[model samples]
Target: MIHEDSPHRSATPGWLAVRLPVHALWLSLAVLAWFAIAAFAPRFGLLDWRAGLGFMVMTAGPLLLGLAVLVAALALALSLRSRPRGPWWKAALALAIPVIIGASLLQLRATAARVPPIHDVATDVVDPPQFSASTMALRDAAGANPLSPYNVPLGQLPAWQGRVEGAQAIQTHADLIGQHYGRLQPIPTGGRDPAQVYDAIVAAMADIGLRDIRRDPDAGIVEGVARTLAFGFRDDVVVRVRDGRIDLRSASRVGVSDLGYNAARLERLSRAIERRLATP
Candidate 1:
């Protein structure tokens, strides 16, 4: 005769006892450590953005996340039959970190898919604002994406967002940019000449957080570099205020895809310029 409080029987059934094993927390902690190294390495200058973010985070993060998730799931399954709860809630909490990171990575991948693979973004695509000699020297010395619209060497290219080789990559990038970002055009100067708006343009550039801003009033060019907050990735920006219009170009110093970052930055700068021009 079995009793209701029999020692052989579990007070909590398998369904209610379904909890992750405490040991699984170690897997989650490992993933958290990997995430920290991957994310902060570039910002701290411990590693280059290409190596830290592109290779470590984007390339290796998913594998670790998958392993963590699998271990947590398996641990939970095995612990379901165990009588002791065994700090299972802490294990469940730990599991959330990898899942969240995996979701964020997926979102980033989706954003990359939506945008063109080109790192260079220009308001004037027909005749994109050329970088100054010094700026070109800076970029070239650092092995940046070529200022030329296309004809990038295959070997020099970073891991592109899209699977393309040689000229096809650039062509596809151009076509996609034209399709999705045709609205990125020169900002009107409201009947003001380049001379009138030159100072305001410089002010706008500074207002929008551009650093090392160099202005050539005679040439009507205001150039600066924008460093990203997370990875410290540098994108060169050259603003051409000419012919009663302001055209801007933002090009990443590395990588095959800016993940729509340059375009978004240009949009913010464009708005800043417009606001400055509107102000008395």
Candidate 2:
């Protein structure tokens, strides 16, 4: 029988002392590998963006990270008292993995909370420029988020606002646009020919990294799809030149909240168009 004060005695049980550090090391590596797959698999079309982001990255990632943290903490604590010092470096590395990932996830959550939960943005919220039939067809086929009506003419706002208890009066998408992004108004053509403005818009779309551009000069509309750099998620953008003003509308093909991507895209495209028009 081994005595409590025997020279060979260790604070951690023999089986546990060996297993915990090993588990910590492998768990940390698994977290790193899973993160890469979650981020890049969608971009390469290996998986759907929704599945990759919603399930793998946001859900499973956190779960794995939580496990890693728990396991690593146990390992580190036991290692401090183990006669032959446990692999302290392995526990430290495992702990570091979750810390980094948790920080990034927190930052992303903060950004999402700051923005209104809307995906469509337009320069003219009232009767915003409409997408073409073909463009609408593509969006429909892909199960894109439907464009909210210009205003709540369907009488949704009043119905939502009428309740006395537990009622949160919320504005329609159009009203949200006006409240949050009132500065995004139409760009004046300055008496420039509509055709000239159309050409400028096309160049601006290209400059802003849109793909598969389709311009209908006769219809006075230009439309393109913007593929995000990270996940290749598509956002449809259309520009209309009418009534001596240029208007833009950007709607994401998926996602309830764009994290303000559509609004930011419109801002970038508008600035690009304005720059081109001012040059000539």
Candidate 3:
């Protein structure tokens, strides 16, 4: 026969009037603890923990603290039922409240300490082939000799381009290509046409059934997908054919588990290129 009025009247005054400043204190302490951990032992501490600490601090900490506060309020209400008797519930609640709040605050602080900030870049650069004249010429030349690799300068190859010798020469040549063929330093001192190079690469890729071909003639770069065996993968092939020498670089993503697959695919692609070139 508990009456609603009785329940409302039973709520203790001190319990009903929780000091908001106390909660603020807990929050402040939690924030400080997090920062302290981040400043010291940052690597091994919870502050460095990505998933667990972040989730608890960002979502679980507040929820658990709120629940503990509700429980304290309930205890206070029960204590008021024995008014004038000096409710023991009030003492019990007071003791439990601080302990629960402190624990939650500590955990939240640790989580906050571990959480890291994220950064992103913002720019307004237009899409690839920003210039098209070089690309057009590349496409035209590629139509005549798709496998020549002689249409552009060898020093202007893509960064991802490399030879499979597992040697350092590949990287050295790649840098040279960038310096000589990049839009920043066109061959023959301003004579390098990005649009022509882009067009040539696009035409070559098309000849090999590559899709999603994109060219940045302004930057003298091209990227696309090439199909090999039964699967399709992205390719970052840079071409520069200058000084009577042709430099071609083809790169595809590889994973530890797919080493065999990648090797086989590359072999097949090489054979296809050889056959295409021999045809003419």
Candidate 4:
């Protein structure tokens, strides 16, 4: 029997319409927690790095998006039903979480798309600076495959993304770094002495929390490895102090594209060096 003034005749789904704002509240918190797991679990050893990334991209991302839309639509519908507005602000806050996370991820992807899938960058191509014995030993212990951008068999260059992509993509990726970043100029030492410049390079590397620093003062070559905080992924680094120029090379220990991290790292190091020298 339908009443003329039926308050119960509203279209809000009981399942969708939960305790004023609690549904949105829980959903937002869940989305935020999922984001945290995706970001920090790999770093803290709480989750497998590969699995964490996969879950974030494949599962959590889509789930947040779909759930956010569903809840937002339901909330809007309920509010428009001429019934009392239950804590709508909670729904807004809940929706904001997934929206924020999704927007950030999209920006990251857009930046990545603009970058080439090359992991190595150097001042010169003819003879890129070589790493020291310490780095080689560490890589060996870590089971890091051949560390050069050359045509090696699959599983050899684990740091590169193409290794997983297939064997044929190996040389194709190697050619990318050489073709793109070749002729990338070395930083000039402002005519400073090589000894002084080497110290500065060491200081700069230290500022960036580099590992396994190897110094060859006589040869004017300094080598070290940088690691990403989240996954401890390694990037080999070498600095050469010439008469008036300082050459630099940075190559990811794995992955075909470093997401433009290597180039950005070099810029940060360059700025750090300038700051160090600027200090009286």
lDDT of 4: 0.69
Local distance difference test scores for all models: 0.77, 0.82, 0.38, 0.69
Compared to the true structure, candidate 1 yields what TM-score?
0.83
lDDT of 3 by residue, 55-128 (tens): 54445645655655555554444444544333444435443654665576686456434321101000111111
TM per candidate comes to 0.83, 0.81, 0.24, 0.77
**Model 2 C-alpha lDDT per residue in residues 17-115, reported as the tens digit of each score:** 667888997988898888877778888899888787889888888898899889888887777668677777778888888879888889888977776
Misplaced by over 4 Å in model 2 are 1-25, 75-90, 153-169
**Residue-level error in angstroms, candidate 4, position 190:** 3.7
Best by TM-score: 1
CA shift of 280, model 4, Å: 5.3
Which number leads on lDDT? Answer: 2
Stretches of model 3 off by over 4 angstroms after superposition = 1-194, 231-233, 240-247, 256-280
Best-to-worst order by TM-score is 1, 2, 4, 3
lDDT of 3 at 131: 18
Clash numbers, per candidate:
0, 0, 25, 8
Candidate 4: residue pairs that collide: 159-253, 159-254, 159-255, 160-254, 160-255, 160-256, 161-255, 161-256
Clashes by residue pair, model 2: none
